[model samples]
Target: MGEFKVLEIKQSIFEDNDKDAEAVRAELKEKGVFLLNLMSSPGSGKTTTLCRTIELLKNQLRIGIMEADIDSDVDAKTIAEQGVKSIQLHTGGMCHLDADMTRQGLKGLGIEDVDLAILENVGNLVCPAEFDTGSVKNAMILSVPEGHDKPLKYPLMFSICDVVLINKIDVMPYFDFDLEKCKEYIAMRNPNAKVIPICARTGEGMEEWAAWLKEEVNEWQTN
Candidate 1:
């Protein structure tokens, strides 16, 4: 007779994170908060987009932001100046934010009455796409300089995004970025994603972006 040993490996790292994210979603829904998880690589105009978005929407909707960075309060300050409530989440060297950190940032905002909330995830395309931070939508920004080949290079980020902002289009003439190729890649990876181009610095294409934000926020209020 042979005795067989069966080792029990009952551990799930993402389990608790998923649970926390679900709770965060429920909390936002109950409070009528429309949360957007914004992702992008460094120097992609993500912070500028946040500031411009808040400036455009704050008058109509109560908007707040949670700015996640490797280490910096500059983005948060920029958003706050637009009269939008904002909190900076320094990742302390981490590349991205998990549900727990996002929940903590949300708690700090204390803007339950706000109609819209945007979490500016740490400027890294690879890591931010992996975790769900319980946001209503996953948004991403891709600047012209990052190259049109990015969606293929970082497929996860493109695949998970609900909306994609092709930012810094004003610099299109100076760069080798191809508009059609980027759109094609996005379509191939995530056909459902809504894509918008913008130059957040000059306020170009901002109205359309603001319009989408309004509609998203209004729908949040209703649902």
Candidate 2:
């Protein structure tokens, strides 16, 4: 066998992406825009939760949405109906978006007048966690059907998030999902993570989630 060079491509990619992410953050901060990177497994009700959140805070804050997916424009279209600026980002078969990609999406969404820009990241528990999207805050949705052990399974995802939303709580009785146990697991991974239980469909516990977001945006823009 011939001598081969090991380039450490993965590490290099992350290093470059991290640098780009900081630039993205600085740009948002300068514009007084709060960018949120929201992630979850597919069908976790992210869109529905976003819709409910928009309903709650749209009046007070200028909101924008960037819906990223491997394909399809469904989520972007859905968000546009809420009367907020929205753009769809196709990942071109990639599972997650890096900081440069996020920056491009932000530009397309136009953040000059936006106070809160939410990036609905491509649904997945793995790659999305590995890439920094340059958001002010990172949040993920864990629905009841996904099981409480997710935090234990995807520790990186849980540990990186500033907040975790337990969606589909209204069906907890049928799913055997333990809310307390989920929170405990999350704490094990990230002691500072805030966990919110909610049913986006019924608007249950959404007020608290929206309140948290509003406070975060206010703080990001104010300070």
Candidate 3:
């Protein structure tokens, strides 16, 4: 107790991260690359959904993907097999990717010719929501098996997302997930959130998702 020093470390860290995020956003805007930060819990079908999405839009857009994980390059391998530009990002022991990490991943992926670059963030709802990745839009997927009560437990994730994809809708009959109730919960927390129910495996409900993405990318490019 010789000398007591109080440091507001958390606030300072967040402020610095925000500045980096803003710079990343400006750089992406100038290059006309629409980066999407996709967040979700593990087993949410994010990879399958992305494969379907690439199939739908690859002909029209030059797409690249950054598959982020705490370990392993499995998802990146899966995406590369689809013949799109893909890069694997290892976060070491970190749970989330901050703006600087995202910028590094983008550089590795080489976004110069990429029209739409998607960062498939590490599988989690909490840490990913806490950091800004500087994407043009934020999106998350909540599969039917995960239930309709997730928003009640993880409000911040839902609150920050521009769109929420309700994946594994094909298994809705087997699960007790209430689609309308889930939508209600998400809407209560995020009134402007767009919830799209999709079955990525069978390609159901993907058209609507693709259309929304097309519109979003077009808007981002023009304005």
Candidate 4:
């Protein structure tokens, strides 16, 4: 066989995607929109947490949602029930949304009147963390059932997240989920990650989440 040139396709793809992500951010800034990328494993109560967040901030901010899935509109319909503007993004068989895909979703969602745009990304820990979706902030939900060692296992995911919401805290007593240990592990990976314990089912600790979002949106809009 003849000698062949090697191509680092993965690195090249990420470099191109990073450029696209920066473009997406510039466009969002021009429109005064804050795009939040929310990620988690399946059954982590992302939808439930989002619904509660909408209830808290919908009146104060013009929010829009982009529900991304491989091939389902279930989440989009669920968000529509809350009376907010929502659109479903089908990623075909892709495991995650890249910056170009996110830009397309934003265009389809119509950010003209939207102050806050949320992308409920595909439910998973691995692929999503590897791709930057051009979000102003990245947040993830970790449920009690998922255990405290998630940060140790998925260090990249935790490290990239600006905030981590520890969900299902109300059931902490039933499970062996160590909240402090989880926080410690997360801190080891990311010292600045804001960790909040919340129960989406009970509306506990949601105010702090909403307030954090509000402050982020205000900062995004003003500066």
Candidate 5:
């Protein structure tokens, strides 16, 4: 009976998480807020990509961000300077941010007031893949310096991602990162995933990303 009680407790927690995630998504939909959960490994330039995206879309859309980090305030401060409303989430050394933590962060984000809310997950490739933060879309950025094997090595993130942003394309000549191979791997894992090559620093692929986002938002608006 004791073991059965613990199992019941665990089951209840899992069920509760799923229910909460659904509720959060429904609420965001009603508010017309398109939430995107961005995930990537450390140094993959997730924050830089976000800042660039926000800058590009700010004039057209009310952009907001929920920045998740283990300790450093660098990313949050830098994002806030760009004139977008961003809430910093300090995970206190947790490798991944669960739906509950994200719920707390979203409660503080005032998401209903914005058109789009981007959740930048703690810079982690693997663990973040195992969790859902009640986002409308899951975006993953893979930098050229990270090598092409990332999709194969960290399959879950790629598999679950709605879109794959290939960052640091300018560094393609310097690094051995093959964009074609990366696309192939991503396709193998997620055959339907849209892959966009981008140089976040130079804003090369910002337009394409923005266009994709606009399409998604338009569809949401109509449906």
Candidate 6:
């Protein structure tokens, strides 16, 4: 028989990442920094939503943004124009940000002075959900054009997120997207998850989204 070396590679990788994630989370907590790992598909309006969020809370929090992409500083530039601290993280062709990578981004962004650090993770569903980035909370956005069946196709992403934003709701009339069905799908996968519908372009439903964020940040800081 040929020699067989069983590595259990996937299991080992996850275990190692989990340890690093815990350490990163502890360090951030001790520094009073609330990190949010935001994930979504490309063109889901994550940057626009983030811009709206920054506008709403910039006065209340020392906000910082880490825009992770395979290669692009556009989002970082957009965030910087909002007058908040921003950094662009090139993932070197990788599709996700693991704990160590996230820690490095935080260092670049000077997270110690940031009360709220939002990591706009690589624009993908599969890879980002599989790895923990040591964020205080994980959020994903599902635009109405993406359809409600996403939760069924990407259950792990839906299951792991603390909150899910249903973006581009203003176009809900044009698309075949069913809002209730989407909510049902998310609830089935993650009952504890908070789902907020918003049209990031027009600022519709932003107040609710901002309120939830404010509450979460407050809780993260005090606890």
Residue-level lDDT for 109 in candidate 5? 81
Q: Which 10 residues in a row give candidate 4 its minimum summed lDDT?
A: 7-16
- List residue ranges in candidate 2 displaced over 4 A: 1-12
| Reference-based TM-score, model 4 | 0.95
Per-residue CA lDDT of model 2 for 1-223, tens digit only, reads: 9999978545675898999999999999999999999999999999999999999999999999999999999999999999999999999999999999999999998999999999999999999999999999999999999999999999999999999999999999999798899999999999999999999999999999999999999998889
**lDDT by residue (tens digit), candidate 6, 1-223:** 9999977655665898999999999999899999999999999999999999999999999999999999979999999999999999999999999999999999998986899999999999999999999999999999999998999999999999999999999998999999999999999999999999999999999999999998999998998
Of the candidates shown, which would achieve the greatest lDDT relative to the real structure?
4
In angstroms, give how far residue 121 of model 2 lies from its true place.
0.4
Select the stronger candidate by TM-score from 2 and 5: 2
Candidate with better TM-score, 1 vs 4: 4
| Per-residue C-alpha lDDT of model 4 across residues 1-223, encoded as one tens digit per residue | 9889987655665898999999999999999999999999989999999999999999999999999999989999999999899999999999999999999999999999999999999999999999999999999999999999999999999999999999999999999988999999999999999999999999999999999999999999998
Per candidate, the number of residue pairs that clash is 0, 0, 0, 0, 0, 0
Worst 10 residues of 5 by lDDT: 1-10
Which candidate do you rate higher for TM-score, 5 or 6? 6
The estimated TM-scores of all candidates read 0.94, 0.95, 0.95, 0.95, 0.93, 0.95
C-alpha RMSD of each candidate structure in angstroms: 2.8, 2.6, 2.0, 2.3, 2.4, 2.4
Once model 4 is optimally superposed onto the true structure by TM-score, how far is the C-alpha of residue 215 displaced, in angstroms?
0.2
> Per-residue alpha-carbon lDDT of model 1 for 172-215, expressed as tens digits?
99999999989999999999998998999999988898898789
Cα-lDDT of candidate 4: 0.97
lDDT of 5 at 42: 88
